[model samples]
Target chain A: MALDQSFVGRTYPPTDSYEVGREKIREFAEAIGDTNPAYTDAEAAKALGYSDVIAPPTFVFAITFKAAGQVIEDPQLGLDYSRVVHGDQKFAYTRPVRSGDRLSVTSTIEAIKSMAGNDIIDIRGEVHDEAGEHVVTAFTKLVARADREA
Target chain B: MTAKIAYDEVEVGTELPAQTFPVSRATLVRYAGASGDFNPIHWNEKFAKEVGLPDVIAHGMFTMAEAIRVVTDWTGDPGAVAEYGVRFTKPVVVPNDETGALIEVSAKVAAKLDDDDRTVRVDLTAMSAGQKVLGMSRAVVRLA
Candidate 1:
């Protein structure tokens, strides 16, 4: 079934703030085999002018995607969770996310389209710091494959 | 953060050093835990196969992270990246084995997108198992 077009442009309330942690950043970097000092050492990050350890660019995806769950799990949205796959992703940053920053994300449905019997949705997540300053905006595209029975 | 690579020193077509990252099932499990994306297709071979995948696969975000290292390693500052994007073109299949999969990433300066900010656009290619896994992968970096 095609998603309701009315959901387009709908925005969800901001999620509870998630504090960016130094250790989590280190863990994520290590998982990806990235040994960048800036991810693990505050001093190294400071050398780059960041007040503390900064997360890798894609670190905020974990936060934003979780926030998008509000839309994905919306009872009326009618998206089949088991059939969806990440199709595309993009992020534009105002600044690198730093350790100790309390961040929240506001997710909005940017667009919805049905093509070749597949449902495609574009979601935009706006991330902000505790100070309510814009930090970064993430655009995610998810595709729900056509039901096999269809 | 200022990039170690001076913008003035680089031109369109300047190649960033290429890198190859290995992704075992353990790597996917670690990434899943760290990223909070416990999608079973990334770790459970049976579930992945049932879901129509050949085998357990790496998370698309994991591949995206690995692909960006070429740019960050060149800049010497992860913060220098202003924008990044990628399209998941294919699944990175990881069979249960000591050596699972390898993602090869190579990038080049695609264009000088800005003058005052000293920013340039980088085009990246991510390949696995002789197939392109990411399409239209690119980054906009602010360089010193």
Candidate 2:
């Protein structure tokens, strides 16, 4: 199915706040084979100038992907979730992600297009701290590769 | 807690040695288990082709994780990485074969950020089948 161009510029509301936890950070670090002390020890993070244990750079993916679900599960967008492919992801950070920080993401539909028998949709996620400070802007491109005649 | 490579010992254009990581079906499954993301497209080839994908593909995050490992492993401490990001440019197609699959990755000192803090930023790349699967890759690390 073709994407609804009318939904091109829609902006979704911010998702419920997600609290970062040290155990979660440690789990993520272990899963990625990263034995960084700052990710597991609050004292180590303090030594490095953070209020608490900091998350790995890619930890934001969990937050952004969850927030993006609002846009993906929207029937108004006419997207076939089964046909989607993850094209690209980019993040611009104003600050690092820390374990104790509560974060929320506001997802916006950045672009919608059709190319080479594929439908492309770009969703940009703006991650902010509990105090509403911008932390990172994560961009994700989802491509629907279904063979459809235009 | 810090990188072995000193800021003064390396030039801005020095390339970190490239690495090739073999991605077997088992590895992808292990990644799915670790990440709590069990999307069928990464493990089920039939499901992938039915959804218009060429075949079962490696998770984008998996590739990014590998690329970051190249940097963090060099620094000897994941905490040394203050910042990092990547653009997923292509899908890594993983076929269910004996050789499984493979992705080749490499890094370079893209930029030198000399602050009083003793750190430098490293940029890296991960590729499969000659397609640039990752881009705009940047990492900030504290040096010894």
lDDT computed for candidate 2:
0.80
Off by over 4 Å in 1: none
Relative to the true structure, candidate 1 reaches a TM of 0.99
TM-score for each of the candidates: 0.99, 0.80
How many Å off is the CA of A105 in candidate 2?
0.5
Candidate 2 lDDT over residue span A60-142, tens digit each:
88889989999999977878776677777766667668887889999999999988768999999999999999988888888
Give the residue spans of candidate 2 off by over 4 A: B1-10, B17-26, B49-55, B75-102, B111-123, B128-132, B135-144
Model 1 residue A19 lDDT score: 95
Q: Quote the true-contact fraction of every model.
A: 0.88, 0.35
**Best prediction by lDDT:** 1
Ten-residue segment with the worst summed lDDT in candidate 1 chain A?
A76-85
Interface RMSD of 1: 0.6
Binned by DockQ into CAPRI classes (incorrect, acceptable, medium, high), candidate 1 is high
